[model samples]
Every structure is written in C-alpha cells, then in structure tokens.
Target chain A: MTVKVQREDFDVGAELAAMTRGKTSIGGVTLFVGLVRDMAGGESVSAMTLEHYPGMTEKQLEAIEAEARARWPLDDALIIHRYGRLEPGDQIVLVATASAHREAAFESCHFLIDWLKTKAPFWKLEATPEGERWVEAKDSDDAAAARWANQDGDQKG
Target chain B: MKVLYFAWLRTKIGVAAETVDLPPEVKDVGGLVEWLKTRSPKHAEALANSKVVKVAVNQEHVPYDHPLSPGDEVALFPPVTGG
Candidate 1:
C-alpha cells in the first residue's frame, strides 16, 4: 500500500513500474488519473488551487485505501494526490490497484477514487474569468460513492 | 485545545488556527462551535450555519455531537470537494 500527498507532479509510468516491479503474481492493473480541467460549470478556469488539511488528508487517504484493501483481494494499491496551485491539464491525482484478476483491480480502483471524492479533506478553488470561486461538492459524486455502499455483498472481491 | 479552520472558513475567520481554553460548559463539538462563535463576529459569521460546516476531532471526521477532550485538535471546514 502506498499513499502520498505532495506539491509536485508525478509520473504515471514510473509509479506503475515501481508498484509492480517484481510482483509476477499480479495479473491486471487498473488506474485512474484525475486532471485539472480548463473549464468548470461552463466557465473557463485559469488555475486551480488545491487546499488540504496537512495531517488529516493523509490519515483520511490511508483509511480510504485500507477500506479498499479489506473489500478486495488486492496485491498492491497506490494513491498519489497532489496539492497546491495547478493550471489546466495538470495531473491532480492517481489511483492504481493491482490484483490477480481484472475484476478486483478494476472495482477496487473505482472504489478508491469514488470514496476519495467525498471522504477526502481536499478542496479546490478555481480561478475563473469572473473571479476565484470554491468548487462545490456535487450530489453526483455522493451518488457515485453510494452505489458501492449499496452493493457491498456483490462487489466484495 | 487547538482549533483549526480551513479553505473559506480560514479565509473568513482571518486565522488558520488558534489555541483556546474551553469553558466548563463546552463538552462536545456542537458546544465548541457555540463557544467559538462568541470569540468574534467573524467566527460567528463563518460558523453561523451548522449544517454547512464539517467538523473533525483529532484529524478524524466526526459529528457535531462527538465529545471533545481538553487537548483534542478540532477542525472546521466546508464539505470536501476533493478528488
């Protein structure tokens, strides 16, 4: 298990390679990368500043990763989330899960990102043409996380 | 106890964190908010709506009714929009 919150960017290929260096037992790997969008709510965004609680962010992420591990037969899992100011097209987060099969890898990867959206303590402030505005938590994000909670038995890997 | 604010709450409150000596009447997270509101108009305004403010006790998310200890670290902020 690996979890990190940093101000610098990350390399996806390097991270994936390091995660599965000598793990021949792993059959499949699933990854999700969250990027800073140039537009939000139909407005053009110039920059996005990510703010997070220093200690609590790592604690919450660790808890989220642990939950995914407990629910799946994952050989390894990695969560790298970046903080501080970022412009459009910058990578904001990466969630990768490796398992012996594709199903566990795919589902656990999705679960990690979905849970992170609602449970994590980071907030985004987008600088739009109008002004700097804080992004609001979407109901769709809550619904996304809720589906996993609803189908707990079927999704267990 | 150390009380922290973040995001817009930090901006509105004009300070990131502060140490406060709680009165005897403050025993839970809800009571802490009520007591903190009296610190200044900014505190009262930022924490006016209890429904919008999220609380964490000692780096863990908890409900407003969660009990508080003498040295517990408390944080207040808006709903998380992180990815």
Candidate 2:
C-alpha cells in the first residue's frame, strides 16, 4: 500500500509500474485519474487551490486505503492526491488497485475513490471571474458514499 | 490545545492556528465551537453558518458532539469538496 499527498505533480506510469513490479501473481490492474474540471456551477474556472491539513490529510487517506484493502483481496493499492494551486486540465488525484482477478481490482479501486470523496480532509477553493469561492460538497457525493454503508450481502460495496 | 483553521475560515478568522485552554464547560466539539465564536467578531462571522462548517478532532472526521480532551488537535473548515 502507498498513499501520498504532495504539492508536486505525479507520474502515473511510474507509479503503476512500481506497484506491479515483483508481483507475479497479479493479473489485473484498475486505475483512476481525477482532473480539475474547467467548468463548475456554470462558471468557467480560472484555477483551483486545494488546501489540506498537513498531518491529517495523510492519516485520513491511509485509513481510507486500509478500509479498501480490508474489504477486498487486493494485492496492492496506491493513492496519490495533489494539493496546492492547480489550473483546469491538471491531474488532481490517482487511485490504483491490483489483484489476481479483475473483479477484486475493479471493485476495490472504485471503493477507494468513493470513500476518498467524502472522507478525505482536502478542501477546494476555486478562482473564477466573479471572485474566489470555496467549493461546496455536493449532496450527490454524500449520496454516492452512502451506497457503500449498505452492504450487499457477503460482498462489500 | 491547538485549534487550526483552513480555507476561508483561515482568512475570516485572520489566523491559521492558536492555542486555547479548554474551559470545563467546553466538553465537546459543539461547546468548543460556541466558545470560539466569543473570541472575536471575525470568529462569530466565520462560524455563523455552523451547519455548513465541518470539524475534525485529532485528524479524524467527527460530528459536532464528539468529545474533546485538553490536548487534542481540532480543526475547523467547510465540508470537503475534494475528489
């Protein structure tokens, strides 16, 4: 497991390669990359500044990753989230999960992102033409995260 | 105890962090927030919309009523909008 919160950009290819190396049993890898959108609330975003608690951000992310690992048969997992100022079209976060089967890899990867959306300690402040505004958490994200609380029989959501 | 602010809260409160002695009545997160508002007008304005504000104790996400100890690290900010 690898979790990092940094101000610098990351190389997805390098990370994925490192995660897969020396793991001969791995047959599948699922990865997700999050990008800053150019438009929010019908306004064009000039840039976005992500703020996070220095010590708390990593702790929260590690807990999220640990939860995903416990819920699946994942061979490896990695999450890298970038903080600080970023413009639209910039990569913001990455999540990758590896397992012997595609089912475990895909489900665990999906779970990591869903949990990170609401549980993580990062906040976004966007700069637009009108001025700067703190991004509000959408009800849709809460709803999406709630789906996991309800277990689907023996398998975890 | 250390009370930290972030994002707009930092700007409104006019400081990133400060130390405060927890009064006996300030037993929980809710009580702490209520007491913090009395510190200054800026705090009152920033915490006016308490419903929208989020709190974390010792780096973990918690509800408003979560208990607090004397040395715990508490943070105040808006709801997380991160991906």
Candidate 3:
C-alpha cells in the first residue's frame, strides 16, 4: 500500500496499475476520487487550502488502511491526498482498493474514504463571500461511518 | 516547550508559534490550555470556546487529558475540514 500527501496531481490509473502489477489473482478494483466542490452548505467557495501534519498524516492514513485490511481480503490499497492551495473542481483525494472479489474491494474502498473523512488530520479552509472560514464537520459523514459499524456481523471474507 | 498553532487558531491567536515554560502543574494538553487562558486576555477569549479549538500532542489528535512532558510539542487548531 502507498499513502502520499503531496502538492502535485496524481494519475489514478497509473497508481492502480502499479499496485495491481504482477497480480493475476485480483479480480476487481474499486476507486474513489473526491473533488473540491464549488459550493458548500449553500455558500460559494472560491478556493480552498488544505493543511496537514507533515509526519503524522501518512501514519494516520496507513492505520486507516490497516483497519480496512483487517475487515476485508484486499490485495492492495492506495491513498493519495493533496495539500496546499486548491480551487473548485480540483481533485482532492483518491482511494483505490483491489481484491480477488468485487464485494471486498468495493466495500473496503468505501469504508476507507468514509473513515478518512472524519479521522484524518487534514483541515480545509474555504474562501467565501463573507470571508475565509474553516469548514465544519458534517453529521452525514458520521452517519456514513456508522453504517459500516452496524454491519459488523454480515461481512464476508 | 514549543507551541504551534495552525489554521483558524493561528488566525485568531495572530501568531503561528510560541515558546514558554509552563508551570509544573500544567501536566497535560488540557492543563496547558487552562494555563494559556491565563496568559493574556486575547488567549482567554480565543480559547474560551471549545467548539472552535482542537488540540494535538506531538502532531496526533489528542484529548484534553493527553500527557505533556517537558520539551514536548503541542499544537492547537480547529477541527479538520479536509476531503
């Protein structure tokens, strides 16, 4: 698995290809790309700046990936998050998971992103008409992660 | 000890970092915050609201009770809003 926090753009296809390289056992790959939205909570966001703890960000991401691996039979996982200034329509994050079956790969990929939403140390500053404000955490994200927790017994390895 | 501030906290505090020798009784992040509240009127005002402030110990998210040792790095910021 590879987790990177960088200012440069990433190639999702290349990353997935490299992770799945030399692995014929993998039958499915699931990916998620999170983009910077132009509007948030009815406010127009002109630009956004992302900041994170340099050394601990990657460690937190790896721990999240480890939790996903414990729950699923994933072959590989990759997370790439961008830091620094970004505008609307810019790609903010990419999460990809591969496995021998589609179920584990898809579920684990979704789980990783959901967990990262709240658990990761990165923060966002949005520029609005009034002024720049730090975005607030959403209840919806907490609910999304709760759904996975409620399904503990039904998971199949 | 060195204290680092980031994001909205930095904006409110008006400085990115500072160094000070906290009292021996200020044993953790929460105690440190309470001590900071006494440093200046602005600090007391800025940290009075907990909903806007988040604390970290050595770059990791930590609760108020997280222990603090001499020379340890503590960071204060707002809750994350990243994607």
TM-scores for candidates 1 onward, in order: 0.96, 0.95, 0.90
| Model 3 interface DockQ | 0.62
- The residue pairs that clash in candidate 1, if any, are none
The runs of at least 3 residues in candidate 2 whose Cα sits more than 4 Å from the true structure, single-residue gaps closed, are: A152-157
**Candidate 3 ranges with C-alpha deviation above 4 Å:** A146-157
What lDDT is reached at residue A93 by model 2?
A: 98
Per-residue CA lDDT of model 2 for A70-150, tens digit only, reads 888989999999999999999999999999999999988887898798888888999999999999888888877778767
Q: Which ten residues in a row have the lowest lDDT in candidate 1 chain A?
A: A148-157
TM-score (0 to 1) for chain A, all models? 0.96, 0.95, 0.92
Off by more than 4 A, model 1: A153-157
lDDT, candidate 1, A1-157, per-residue tens: 9999999999999999999999999999999999999989999999999999999999999998999999999999999999999999999999999999999999999999998998889999999999999898888988898888888855321
Error of 2 at A108 (Å): 1.2
Quality class of the docking in candidate 2, CAPRI style: high
Which candidate has the highest lDDT of all?
1
Rank candidates by TM-score, best first.
1, 2, 3
Model 2 accuracy (lDDT, Cα): 0.90
C-alpha lDDT of all candidate models, in order: 0.94, 0.90, 0.85
Tell how far residue A39 is off in model 1, in angstroms: 0.8
